[model samples]
Target: MSDDRPLDPVQLDAYFALIEVSSLLRHTVEQQLKESGGLSYVQFQLLATLGDAPSGRRRMTDLADGVVYSRSGLTYQVGLLEQAGLVTRAPSQEDERSVVVTITDAGRAVLATVFPGHIAVLRELLLDPLSDDDVEALASVLDRVRAHMRSIPPRSAAPRRRAPTR
Candidate 1:
């Protein structure tokens, strides 16, 4: 089931570079989110997603999928946000079994506080060194890779099966 062939030098170098850069970027972003808004990266993502939605609301399952997070983890984060008065959870009127999350005004205010710093960090660490052409190429490549990865069933769609006992 395994390929015997190893990655070529170019592929190995690119893979390592990508992994390192992604880690660095996420670490910086996490720090910025925590410092500016007292939010974790995941919490910021949830609020930003809801804030960008047309109605400032989304179903729990949809949020999990959109954020590429586990439903249980998303639930925990939502609970924290609810406790902080940053968001609300309510039953969906259209679907009795579904719960919807809506961002509060306070959440928007946090976004406003954090976004400027976030953008500045991104610009300084990630984008400033890139040429316009490099930026466009990177965006295009990432978009395609993301779409391909997302074609698989997301964690929110179903629970993982338990392993059979020996």
Candidate 2:
């Protein structure tokens, strides 16, 4: 059952702080990615994920899960990347029903171009201010929270419902 009570003051402060920090960090990262590589944050994430994969490729559903994005949204972003010649999609060899997305050499180049700025922004805005202990504590907290959240079924893992016929 859900708790009917409100968050304590400290919890309220932490929640607001997390939200604001997340927004600020994303905004800065988005600007850097767009300026450096002509990519949106999600596009950069897609490329980076594919680039990091052992085979430089991933199934579309896996991509959606890895990036915490909706499948439809991932498809549109992949389409844009395909049009830009940064990525390609093909039917998975292992599963004909699944589409696989792969990063092109050009996509790797874009990642290389943007990664430095991305790291710099992350360092300046997120990490530089934190002491080593603070960083470690934050990491531990986030890891536990992430694991807890992931215990729930992700959107990609859920079966899609069919529309009703008229």
lDDT of 1 by residue, 4-69 (tens): 899999999999999999999999999999999999999999999999999999999899999889
Worst 10 residues of 1 by lDDT: 151-160
lDDT of 1 at 150: 86
Question: What's the lDDT of the predicted structure labeled candidate 2?
Answer: 0.95
Query: Clashes in each model (backbone N, CA, C under 3 Å)?
Result: 0, 0
Where model 1 places Cα greater than 4 Å from the true spot, the runs are: 154-166
lDDT of each: 0.94, 0.95
lDDT tens digits, residues 1-166, model 2?
A: 6889999999999999999999999999999999999999999999999999999999998999888998889999999999999999999999999999999999999999999999999999999999999999999999999998878878666888999999
TM-score for each model: 0.91, 0.94
Residue pair clashes in candidate 1:
none
Q: Provide C-alpha RMSD values for all models, in order.
A: 2.7, 1.7
